[model samples]
Target: MTHHLAPAPLLALTLPSEDVLYAALLARDPAFDGRAYVGVTSTGIFCRLTCPARKPLRANCRFFSSPADCLAAGFRACLRCHPLAPEAAADPCIAALTSALEADPARRWREADVAGLGFDPSTVRRSFRRQFGMTFLEMARQRRLREGMATLAAGGRVIEAQFDAGFDSPAAFRAAFARLLGAAPAEMKGALLQADWIDTPIGPMIAVADKRSLHLLEFADRKALPAELARLRKMAGGIGLGRPQPIDQMADELGAFFAGTSARFDTPLALHGSAFTRAVWEILRQIPPGTTRSYGDIARDMGCPEAARAVARANGANQIALVIPCHRVIGADGALTGYGGGLWRKQRLIELERGYALRHDRQPDDIGQRADGGEAGQP
Candidate 1:
């Protein structure tokens, strides 16, 4: 398969042309570290713009919008820059703490815990807050709460949920639950949706769903993510933080998508929005995986040509990421516009889909390519 990217006008505006990107690479600009990746054709390696290694000749360089793109182009990660690592992985302390948290999310983490872990509490707090917009303790608290929610979603007793979540007292657990969920623990026993996190090549994403359908999917770093979850909780009557069947299915589908094996999503969706917004989202779903449409094109298709701005607003409001294909919508002039997940992510997604489309079209037998060091030349 030979995947051809969409026209330049349809990609995000943040990406510079090859010549400009090459100039940035030659200068070794730190500003472009996470924004772009360079694939050295001669060496078959990709590197971050801030890599300390010597620059390759411009003629041998093939600029990519993401590390995934470089990998797709049959390039390996640069040892010096560790281009495959997430941005947060640059901080050893953050990496260690996050690994510990992932290992035991139910642990009752405290300020003393940081001290015991060989980190200054104040320094750890500052670093975590700066990097993730939340204190380490706060993250632990949320993790415990999620565990409790998971227990409840899995049909455990309230007391079991509390203790399982690492809360020492029932009153404390109830108070925390009420504060974050706007409902007492006992009052949340009804059919509740589950919220969980899934890591992607771009970043971590939060997925919320009930047994039947997905409700919300957004990047964890989005500022409005908390508020979006709150809205869903309120609308759902009650929601637990856990891994439900729907979430598992979503995780599998997302894994397949990033791997380039499949772009089609069969997980059911539970959309919550105004009628007009729902209409716009439905149209967005109709967009093919490798194709794109301008906001004006969508609005005009809906027989509301004058409502392009309104359509764009609805596009921004969508919580579901790749599933709804909102990233496929572009500005009238074909430049990438605002996306809640960030323009860089939008660009990467477009490129990924283009790669997949190219592979599928040319080699019908070759379904896709995985980003994690699988077959490179396909999707």
Candidate 2:
């Protein structure tokens, strides 16, 4: 299937025309690194315009102003270009505020609330715009919309959801819902696949599943999350809020994994992707929690030595997070690189997994790697 990145918002965000952005991308011009990002329709990945990796065809490229825009349109940050780096994550103030916002995505924010946190609201706005190309309040409002929709999806009354999401009124709530997910709040819920909000040490996660397997698992604050939820709803007929057996099992397994007690995730997954992508995910599963692999390493294991970029694309495409262990993949030069969940969470996950490796007596060379280049047995 041919996937096209959404064009309207991308066009609106850039002052430069698509032709100019395409030219910059071809030239790999550093001048447009932060100002413009290129989303590849074929690979479902977005990269900095100046990324050193191979460029996609002009027809396949969509330009966005920020990583948040790229992900909200359902494109994963490119592993090779580290598009999500030097991101809001690199700013200590933004990082600290976003962390709090992530933990309580349902909470409403105001200038007072921000000042209460010891940050100047004006400074926060400028910093967020500088790094993420949007204001911190804008990001927070997006979270509120997700939380409200999640409530409605989970079977809450519209008024109940409105209040739960801290909105001023039902009209405001419904309007925000329509703007964010392109549907009225009442039209968002269904009964086929069940959705639930799960909390982790890193942050909250949304798990969508049926009776048998997990269909989607992602961080709640992920820019792509709202889009992913909408896609699942359309594909599965409808998704309601409820805890299925698989989700319960997953919650337990995740608890153990994050606590450094176990690395095994036996929660049956509904892996979505092409055959090649599935093969890459399987290799990621074999990577044992405490070890890491480069994209080149994964491609070599798949017997496609020249498909390193493809492997990175597939790695970024994974939505199931920890259960699939995409965090175990890193740059060839031993960098943390980019992560859809933000690099801070990636770093923490690696640190947590290292303890799991140590308990099993399989210490890694740097963080989650084996120096001698031999795969260790599963924990």
Candidate 3:
């Protein structure tokens, strides 16, 4: 007698060919843990492949290699799976410390404080750095600063902001603020260049601008941000905090870009670079939103085939972020290269651009900043 086999699940028919990641997502496969992540477009959240939460559909799934990649695609971390935890808490020390951090995010953490928790400070540091690319202390400090910025943005006094940040000294608080933002809380008066936080789908960006032109824009968490802001302060005039007209304008354009409503960054940019770099950037802006170009291609376009390396350098040097569109450049072999914002963000930008309705292709329109400000477009 012939044996009868069970029918395959109907879901298998809907999956992309050779879709191993989605299969792993459905299976709650431990093999893909830390090796794969899934972003649920419908829920706007990402999860580990082993996440036990009810699975999303194939149509809504976007797989990524890491949490950073999911974040760049505007997906928030799955609180249930704790996908953002370093190594998903492979180390017991990391698990405990991160749990404590989640419980008390504003707690002022010190090396001694970490030691007090019965963890070897050095071990904890190494574990966190190896897993998260940052020490536990640094992560704690950034959390505190996020809280502090919330206080300041809501029109609270500087001392109130400092207190909220859990800083022991007002001076130390001001110094940290200056280190991150290139200006003390008190010095945010009417300086020539004003800075404000513009929330995008990927991250919070600090946009520094004058009345009519944007000068500097970079992700707040970028490693080079403080130094870039310092240089901008030196080259331009005093750097202050508060939304200038240009900052307001940039915030709106960013809103449109992320919404896929428009890819036209028409806000006047005050490009700061050598003439060659400036020329390279102009070529960058001309590349259509949905298309990418190689650095070598850009060099060839500039009539300097030998300048491909220089073009790559200029692409890395661009501080204006999306406005200058440096993320559009790729390697000669069609590989995505380093973006100042992170490779995850570069991938997301490319993914996002593919959906954009280019401004040149559509009728002109004005989009205004929301009166309700604070971390807009956060998913």
Candidate 4:
């Protein structure tokens, strides 16, 4: 079977040139990181360009160059092979805001204040809503109320707790405390807030993290979701789920990526995979947003060119999606291949990246490649 990334856009985004895109796939260039993805029409799944599954036919191959392109076309993500989890999350501003809010439970941040930190208010709001299913202000307020609960548990005076939490008035603080803990600040001391919930192209995702770092990222539909939740509950101990700040940041970065803004991500990620898989994922990270590669090429790059099939297996096993960029990997024949998402989405992702590549200042001689990694020596 000859798999190929999309050579044109399925919707608003454009696919990379067939030849150049193929080369990236063949070489597993890692240069195309998050900018492009592939879908297998035959299998009804989408994957990062780095997926190692057997190649599908060109006619059955569809390219999606962006995450938005895939979702816009209505392709669901693959479950057995999770494609949404990326290798390393590196979104700095989001991380910083999350830390600051957690550290100062009493402080309230205004939209303008967040914007002053170099993010558009709308972007921040949207990111939070998509990932954590809440707005920043809402999350922050919840944090404050949780702090009040803790202070109360420690036997602090209600008035002092309110002021210590940076609340201007005791009345306002008490109201918030009641809303979250089901009572006023004076009613309970040991109560706390827990965090969870996020939506993705595949389905609703759940995340639980505290002041330190994000601890878990799992799909809600997983049969083991209950067990996963249990683990989180235990990990958090008494911390409980408060405002999901990290999830919000992920949602925002993903939204921009799908839209093809070329805005690099700086989210701190916790890759949960074997050492080899983690290594493969890291290599995928180095691939530029608008480039691609092949399983064989990736294997060779890793000093095991003969282990191309092994490379593909690792790609198929990737849980994180856009960040690790398995979508950038294609078949040796330059056709769209196996993807956990769907073929239509793959075609669309490729098209979006190619469009960006066309406008990305490539030299004239390099313009002829399809970006699929198949056109290396073909006439």
Query: Per-residue lDDT tens digits of candidate 3, residues 82-197?
Result: 67753335467877987798789799889988888899999988866644446889878876876777688667899899999989899988888877886788776657887778
- The TM-score-based order of candidates, best leading, equals 2, 1, 3, 4
Question: What would you estimate as the lDDT of candidate 3?
Answer: 0.71
Q: Count the backbone clashes (under 3 Å) in each candidate.
A: 4, 3, 0, 103
Instruction: Give the candidate number with the greatest lDDT.
Output: 1
Per-residue alpha-carbon lDDT of candidate 2 for residues 98-144, written as tens digits (9 for 90 to 100): 88987888777888999998999999998776544457888788677
- CA RMSD per model (angstroms): 7.8, 14.8, 13.3, 16.6
Candidate 1 vs. true structure, TM-score? 0.64
Q: Which residue pairs clash within candidate 3?
A: none
Native-to-model Cα distance after best TM-score fit, residue 371 in candidate 1, in Å: 25
Clash count, candidate 3:
0
* Residue 205 Cα positional deviation in candidate 1, in Å, after optimal superposition: 6.4
Estimate every model's Cα lDDT from 0 to 1: 0.73, 0.70, 0.71, 0.56
**Per-residue error at 51 for model 2, in Å?**
25
Q: After superposition, how far is residue 364 of candidate 3 from its true place, in Å?
A: 10
List the candidate 3 regions with Cα displacement exceeding 4 Å: 1-140, 146-156, 357-379
* Clashing residue pairs found in predicted model 1: 3-358, 9-334, 259-369, 259-370
Q: Where does the lowest 10-residue lDDT sum fall in candidate 2? A: 370-379
Which prediction has more favorable TM-score, 2 or 4? 2
Query: Candidate 4 residues 254-319, lDDT tens each?
Result: 566566555355556655567777778777665554566778767767777788887888887655
Give lDDT: candidate 4, residue 296. Answer: 76
